[model samples]
Target: MYLTSSRPDIVHTTCLCARYQAKPTENYLKEVKMIFCYLWGTINTGLWYTKDSGFELTGFSNAYYAGCKDTFKSTSDGAQFLGEKLVIWSSKKQDCTALSTAEA
Candidate 1:
């Protein structure tokens, strides 16, 4: 959890890696160990909230057309924030086809 929260740069890679966790090979285990070592070496790394930034809330939504090769379904993505904190995010496959980005 800490690793996922702290390392946004690796989120995509980690998610791909996690798909193999149910049947992880030796290489996958090695990569997991490396991530653990990185976390152990940088345990102090995390968000440091402050009070005086005069922050505001903002959000964004994005989607891709026909992201699933097998089903040809679209994918939707969203991210919301309060100040500089990331409050919510999601990536999911859409149930219907999107004619355009707007439709998605």
Candidate 2:
């Protein structure tokens, strides 16, 4: 949870794993270890901000609809940026049958 602020790249995976924390299986354990291994391998990576760049606020979003398997729902992901820095991001399961970003 502490690393999410600094490591937006890993947030979605982390959250996905977290959803099964109440009843974690062997696969989840392996996935968690993989996340740790990935972090260790990229210990030197980080976002950098330059002083003279423009701070244009931009947002991007995408979503997918599978079917009526478990009610009408969609999986969506999005990121919002203030200038070049990420301000908000999320991967969500929403209660709608959305196929694309605009519909979601």
Candidate 3:
């Protein structure tokens, strides 16, 4: 949830990985363990919202065409922010295939 809320660009890949969370295979488990290891190695890393950071808001969004192999669904990604502080991010696969980028 943190990653999804802080970095929308990773949502497609994260959700794709999450789909296998219910019945994780050995490969998926290994990947998850690797993430844990990475987290352990980066324990000192942190995000800071400084007082000097102005409260300017900005956002960006994007999508990939047919990113899901199983569903052939287009993935949408977006992020919202207040000043330099990230407020929200999301990535989700659409229920229907988009005929074009405009349709999406």
The best candidate by lDDT is 2
Q: Write the per-residue lDDT of candidate 3 for residues 1-104, one digit (tens) a residue.
A: 46655434445556777878888789878876776676677666655677888788999888888777777778887877788877777788888998877767
User: Could you tally the backbone clashes for each prediction?
Assistant: 0, 0, 0
In order of appearance, the predictions have TM-scores of 0.54, 0.75, 0.74
Q: Which stretches of candidate 3 lie over 4 Å from their true place?
A: 1-12
Candidate 3, residue 31: Cα displacement in angstroms equals 2.4
Worst 10 residues of 1 by lDDT: 7-16
Model 2 RMSD vs true structure = 3.3
Model 2 regions lying over 4 Å from their true place: 66-73, 95-104
- Compared with the true structure, model 2 gives a TM-score of 0.75
Candidate maximizing TM-score: 2
Which tens-of-lDDT digit does each residue in 1-104 have in candidate 2? 67877888897778667767998899989999999999999999987877765689999987666423445566677999888777788877676577654675
> Tens digit of lDDT per residue, candidate 1, span 12-60?
4465457567888898888888877877887777666666643688998
As for TM-score, the candidate ahead, 1 or 2, is 2
So what's the TM-score on candidate 1?
A: 0.54
